[model samples]
Target: MGKALIAGVMRWQNTLDLTMSPGNVVAKPLEHVIAANDANKFIAYNNIPPDIPKIKTKSNSKANKNKC
Candidate 1:
């Protein structure tokens, strides 16, 4: 499975194994990739809450660029 650098942003992942024979470097099927994602979700974001709290980006400071 592809390492979760961030999160699974794309549907496809390069799990192509190069340790085996040169001819065996083919990518796995989409179903396997999807399953890997399912397993990865828990390990990756397990510490995070189900509904991540939104950060308050609004600021009343004069330095705010969007104040206009």
Candidate 2:
């Protein structure tokens, strides 16, 4: 397995344990960093840019307007 994949797996396991145990506020930042690095590594290896889906908001103006 690649370094990134290994790192990711380790971080995931750590995060899971932390979540299950509770009260590890001090480790949250490090956990986040690990997760972010894992994501970056995966993205780099896949050679695909991250695609964040856009949220579509519905406008109520048309439906709320008084009909003349």
TM-score of each: 0.17, 0.19
Give candidate 1's whole-model lDDT: 0.43
Q: Could you tell me the lDDT of residue 51 within candidate 2?
A: 75
Misplaced by over 4 Å in model 2 are 1-16, 21-23, 36-68
Score residue 37 of candidate 1 by CA lDDT.
Answer: 53
lDDT of 1 by residue, 22-59 (tens): 34434333334335353544323443445567444434
**Candidate 1 stretches greater than 4 Å from native:** 1-13, 16-50, 58-68
